[model samples]
Target: MRIRPITRDEITELVDDLWLPFAGEMGDIDEYDALAEDVDVRAEALDYRRTQLDDDETQTFVAVSDDELVGYTTVAYSESPPVFARDSGAKVKDLYVAPEARGEGLGTSLLERAHEWGRDRGCARISLSVHARNDAARSCYESMGYETRYVKMDRPL
Candidate 1:
């Protein structure tokens, strides 16, 4: 497998493909339909990510094997909201490895490349958020030396 920076034209396909599994994974929850109700919202979100990719502050990397796209990741400077304390580091916004590629080290390889990209930008830390129910992903992150720093809880009103 090999890792490289994402190309400009690959953004749409990358974002769209990742959302498929993401939505499927969350479909088990009752709130998923409500959250995914607006198709336009999905398009807008992809557009937003496309725009961000043009910014120097954000970077995306892809992992390839046998000339096929196997995994991809996106990292950016952590945003600091005035109301909440945020650390100064590169925040991994997305990381996805094709289900068939899970056992391989593609995810870890992508993350390591992200760290090098962060270090090149003078970032002091690397962070990411994973859904509580995604135990496999959580375990992978933990095994890679990541720790939980924050949690957001939700419930039906």
Candidate 2:
């Protein structure tokens, strides 16, 4: 259980596996409206996420077990936290532990690493968005001492 920097090869390997399912669990009404405007906005965002991982600004980590990629988390700053927090904050852009990997403290380890990554950047705090419907993840985050500071409002725009 080492927390380390994500290499290019690791990013490419994890992109297809982690991005879309995470994207599908967004604020529904907002995603729905955006789909009406252009069906590919979510796709574009996933692409952008991968690109950000490739860029210098974003950082990521993975939980490797027995030489297999099992879990991952990403952190990004320099414009963060959805404006709910001030600048110089870091956002947990992604966190996922495969079904078999959950409950082993991997998520917590990944989160701790992400926050450490934030602190290393001189960030004031770390933040992330969880799906309103994902009670399990919400609970996990809450147990980890993260509170719901902002509710992403959703209505037909």
Candidate 3:
């Protein structure tokens, strides 16, 4: 297995397939907010990512095994919002590893690459959001030195 920046051709061939498993993992988090059957998640995500990938502030890295894309991470540097008391930093929007690829350290490799990317751009920090129910990902992030910044509690009432 190897890790590298995603090539344009690979994006065209693998983006949709990659989204499926990623979506499936998130689906396990909560049925109430799961992706709708008709949503075409990958198609929309692909279009959005393609545009973002053209910008200098965004970077995506992919993990390949046996010539197939097994996982990927996407991160972007952003200016602090005017109304928010936050510093400019890199935010990791997606980190997906196929189920079969989970134990091989691809996720860690991708995350480390993201940290390097952020540090290279002089970012103060790199951050990400994991669903509260997603214990595995949360554990992984915590193990990597990430700490809870805020707890988002939701109520249907």
Candidate 4:
């Protein structure tokens, strides 16, 4: 598979293709529900990611197998945010792969490319947020050498 940056025209396709990784096999909610526990994300909430990709500070990446889009990701940066990342170090807002394509190291490959992108742009660090309930992802991040700098928590009555 070839990994490359995304074009604006692929926005909608990206949004739909994202479900493969984030939601699992779509026709049935059972599989999606099982994976959902590991990711702690909803399809509807993904709309925000789609919107962010179209904004000025955000960027999108895609993994293509043949002519098909197998996976995609989103990253962004704030010129004035309180974080300590490089002026070029983008905060990775999204990273996912097709369910059928998982376990094949595509996620690692995707991040490697994303890191290169950040470096090319002068980013010293690539940051991202994952849900607390997403244990598998948390493990993946940890294995990738990311450390917990802080946490955001909330409880609703």
lDDT of each: 0.78, 0.74, 0.84, 0.71
**How far in Å is the alpha carbon of 109 misplaced in model 3?**
0.7
**On residues 1-157, what C-alpha lDDT tens digit does candidate 3 reach at each position?**
7888887777765567686667776887787656777877777867876786788999889988889999999989988878987678999989998888888778889999999999898888899988988888988899899999988888888
Residue-level lDDT of model 4, residues 1-157, one tens digit each, is: 9988787566656766675446553324333245545553555545655676567666778999877788877767545356744354677767888877888888888887877777777767788887666776678888999898889776657
- Per-residue lDDT tens digits of candidate 2, residues 39-85? 66556755666687677768878888877677888888866558565
TM-score of each: 0.82, 0.76, 0.88, 0.72
Q: How much does candidate 3 score in TM-score?
A: 0.88
Pairing residues by index, what is the TM-score of model 2?
Answer: 0.76
Candidate 2, residue 26: the lDDT equals: 46
Candidate 1 TM-score versus the reference: 0.82
For candidate 4, list the clashing residue pairs, or say none: 88-123, 89-123
Counting only residues 3 or more apart in sequence or on different chains, how many pairs clash (N, Cα, C under 3 Å) in candidate 2? Answer: 0
Compare the candidates by TM-score and give the number of the best one. Answer: 3
Candidate 3's displacement at residue 16, Å, is 2.6
| After superposition, candidate 3 runs with Cα above 4 Å error | 82-87
Candidate 1 lDDT, 69-145, residue by residue in tens: 77888889764566766446798988889888888888889999999988887777899978777788888899999
Name model 1 segments beyond 4 Å from true.
28-35, 79-87
Error of 1 at 80 (Å): 6.3
Clashes of 4: 2
Candidate number with the higher TM-score (3 or 4): 3
Per-model clash counts, in order, read 0, 0, 0, 2
